[model samples]
Target: MFTDKLREGSTGPVAKFLFIIIMVSFAIAGVGSYLTPKMDFNPVKVNGNSITNGELEQQFRLEKNKLERQLGKAFREQAKDPAFNASLRKQTLERMITDQVVSDHIFNSGVVISDDLVKNRIREMPEFQVNGKFSDAQFRKVLSLAGYPSPLVFSEALKGDISKEIYLKTAFDSGFALPDDVAVMAQILSQERTFSKIDIAIDAYKKNQTAGEDEIKAYYDSHSKDFLLPEKVKVSYIYITAGDFVNDVKYTDEDLKKFFDLHAELYTIPEKRTVSHILITGEDAEDKIAKVAEELKGGASFEDLAKKYSEDSSSKDKGGKLPAFAQGVMDSSFEKAAFALEKTGDVSEPVSTQFGWHLIRLDGIEPGHGADFNQVKDDVIEQYTKVQSRELFMDKKQIIADTSFENPDSLDAAALAANAAREEGGQVSKSVQIKTSDFIANGDEKAAFPLNQPEVQKVMFQSELRESPVNSDVVELGDNAIVVVHVEGYQEPAPKPLSEVHDQVRDAVLTAKAENASGATLKSVTDSLAKSESLEKYVKDGLIVISGPATISRIKTGDVDAQVASNVFAMPTPEPGNITYKSFAGNNGSSYVLVLSKVVDPKLGADSARDSFLNNQIYNFRYGEDNQIVINSARAESKVEYNENREYLKMQEEQNN
Candidate 1:
């Protein structure tokens, strides 16, 4: 706690921001005033300040966007929870309320936010920075998206946020954790749970209890919809894919020969040449060339002359070297001159191309060889497949669709006519679940087309069930695969009969009774243990007793069940000399009775290993609670009142709906 960076007399803006963050566990920014104008039709009021409905909705939407970004695709699942959505709305509204509360406190407390500070804060914001400087364009673009139409309008909100930060900074800076309180908290946080647990597994009672026929019937009568299936279909589909006929459509030697004859260019490997170059072309090119030729005739080495006088940036070092090249990679004149050389060590006179003059040398030559049928059999087969498939895919696809739509019956006839059809059957529910396989071939999840795609589920579940399963129009999985679904069987949602769901009902009845029995058993055991102070008898009676991990000082115990840990902490600390005991329900369909025989305070050195007293954890926690008290005081002093306009209630109702 004493080693925290946010200490007294720190003047850095960054440090100041951290202090405020620690204040209320909230990032409150800006100070002084509300941004929108007060009006008679205001929907919400905080600290006597009226906030317009439009402003509330705008803030709500901004918060909603942030939540969606955090949630990603999971937001779709969360949206289904009314409680979560309600909490989301409540938190957003509460944020607006908190803003007003904090703003009032800031103004009364004499906290100030200046234009320069606001501008500096904006410029430092990563969203508005381009190439490490504040970009006006980026700032405006962000504002436009955020529904802040003008820089002026956004400045007000920014100013308000800064004011709140200042108010919190003052409050947090004044907070102090007393030495005695720190000792007690540290001891509690570092205490370990040295106790053993007795688990009452639900399975143990299964043999002793059974849901009789009448009980099963009675349970089913009351909870019929529990067994009612969402909507299911038995589908028989014929999948037509390139994979289906890749092996069947074989390429023979004769076929390969014909294919080779048509696309023979692709098989021909062009001749390659190994070459090197040097160039001398500047102001005195003609004069320099004659001197170079004279020096070459006088036995001056070509490499030496090139190194001393060549102007070419490339190949100037390492005595001029170039990679071997094919004909088309170089300029025509250069290619011709280089290829014209009969042997290695041949040199050509300086020749000009687009990149200035060049002194060409032929280091080596490699003759080109055209691949025969035996050398490229795989290529021939692949080319043949691609060519054939391209020419035939459209026709095959259309014919499959036409036949299935026209007949609405046999997939057998369609299979005879297209790429090839393979029969597949499965049950589908309301969504994309198709009983799938882990097996994959060539990186493809080998689900026959219909069940693999969710789009088909949307179609099939919406379509009326047929008595005699028949094919529907083709549903294309992708460009390469297509299939037609036959609704062979279906079961509509209904109250399931006791005979049909007898086993399920029996299990449910048993589980429910087991849970109740476990709860009752737990109460009885805990009562007996507290009175008798002995767990040995219960431990002997098939209650699997195991010692739990050291957890009091532990902040993160991922291996332990969260519910069990929470219940354990919620257990009262043992009376001065006596141990404490409690009962908790386990998520594994079991009951647990935990005994806390001791509170093991952590052993520490001057340079502590434990974190309870480090990082200002206790001080920060107390500050947040104290900061809330200050905010409440400010809000209560304001004498706030709500207009409760009809339109405001209607707006909220519509939003909830």
Candidate 2:
């Protein structure tokens, strides 16, 4: 809102003194050294601050890597989908923008993370530590590998994450729903609907009628478009894999070392604590805990006390041994006590938690650190060689696709250039309609080769066949594999001849006529009931009356289908004299006449695990809503200019979930 400029080179002492103070103030705030890397493209700008394409690309890479790791080969299919990729890219961009907005808010609000805290946080990070202690050399090497130029850049980013976490923690912990909130959720979860339903068996109606040959033929003629065949393609293709190039690609020892140095962070593990406790419960729990605490003070073994007094059977037999885990797994009071111990065998005073009173001990601590280069050189070399091959493969993938696209006749030229082998692949539809295994004879396995799967079956069907067979765009199979196909033959889609589909047409016609006849009866019966009273008289004539869940909550459906529950909940509460009635289809080939019977209020008497769990869920939900509100409101209020060229991205993101 403000900008300062000296009045035409004024040489006054006051102007010089004011300039000095401004410099000193910025130095004190530690903002003088904070530098954001320069980027040339701005896709999103908020309040005059540009969020560059480079920054968004980095976030996109991180998100893609995470998806690939989790989903494996399935992610390749999703990545190739235009809708999925567009949505993912937009989400990644928006999330990064939100983070930037929050970071800027933190800075403007003067919520500073001290230099000392940043130092401690960096020291504590497992990635940059060596043998549980901070290593400057290790830190530098790891950061450089991750593309951080210096400590200042990494530290500033880390500080932002920490500051945002602190603020969110405060917000999350402060949220508490009113007593009515629990009652509302309980009513939704536990509400019961007394419903009267009637199943119309299609078979009963079909028994009196049979579909004639002429009728089946007429039905087939009308729905001919539904049976249209998918286009098929025949091609000869060569497959190139990283494994095929692994032995051929040469790398020096120095190159292996360089690869290892850059990716050092991958080797580190987080600090873990293995602690055990003797849990005490029931009326004499405190007395038992006190006794155990006393025994520990007298140098009595924790294992012996645990075995004698522990009520937890899972660990008591093994002297209260618990598997190692990082913090956040245990109950809060227990974790606080356990993590407080400085060394192995350091025991804690008996701590009381939701589980029980307990005597705790720190069995061991494994300090996290990156391994030195010598310890993992061979494995690193093998992995790095694969990485190089994948890189080489990616570069050749486009060349193969383009060369085949231009040539259109055969894979011979592309195969020779890409060092791939040419093999014949069959023409098949987009699905498992044609099985490769079916083509193989039991005794002639050596002569049968499995058909190559196209990159995207949908795209293959979508692309038109040229007079001269054209090359397909490269289809990537996960990270290391890719293939391009050239059409050798094309098959046009046509309706199936009636003789082969006669049985299917007969079944379809029977089902259609039966459902239509039964549906008319159902509609007439259900409609008349609204005009008359006493549904019980019709109960003996095969009407099914089922009671809905007792009390419905958002998370649980007691007896009714979730869709039924949701529809009913959305309705206005009925007056005492007039009960609400809704008619709908049931899961079975049936119709339903539902009445909202009652709603139950939740009764959470005294504090218990159930209460804790419910409150935690409520808190998290509200916290998320609160976060969305604040961030969205802030974003809405800010003047954001989006590049028109990239607005297609926003359109795709609007398809969220």
If scored against the real structure, what TM-score would every candidate get? 0.44, 0.64
Where in model 1 is the C-alpha error above 4 Å? 1-94, 104-148, 169-186, 228-493, 512-520, 531-552, 556-558, 572-578, 587-590, 608-615, 630-657
Query: 388-448, model 1: which lDDT tens digit per residue?
Result: 6544555666766777666766665555545343234422111111132232121122444
**Candidate 2 global TM-score:** 0.64
* Candidate 1 local lDDT, residue 356: 55
Residue-wise lDDT of candidate 2 within 20-83, one digit each (tens)? 9878977886653445433334578877888777776666766776676568789966775444
Q: What is the lDDT for 533 in model 2?
A: 59
Kindly give the stretch of ten consecutive residues in candidate 1 with the minimal lDDT sum: 426-435
State the lDDT at 299 in candidate 2. 85
Evaluated at residue 586, the lDDT of candidate 1 is 66
Clashing pairs in 1: 29-161, 29-162, 30-159, 30-160, 30-161, 30-162, 30-163, 30-164, 31-160, 31-163
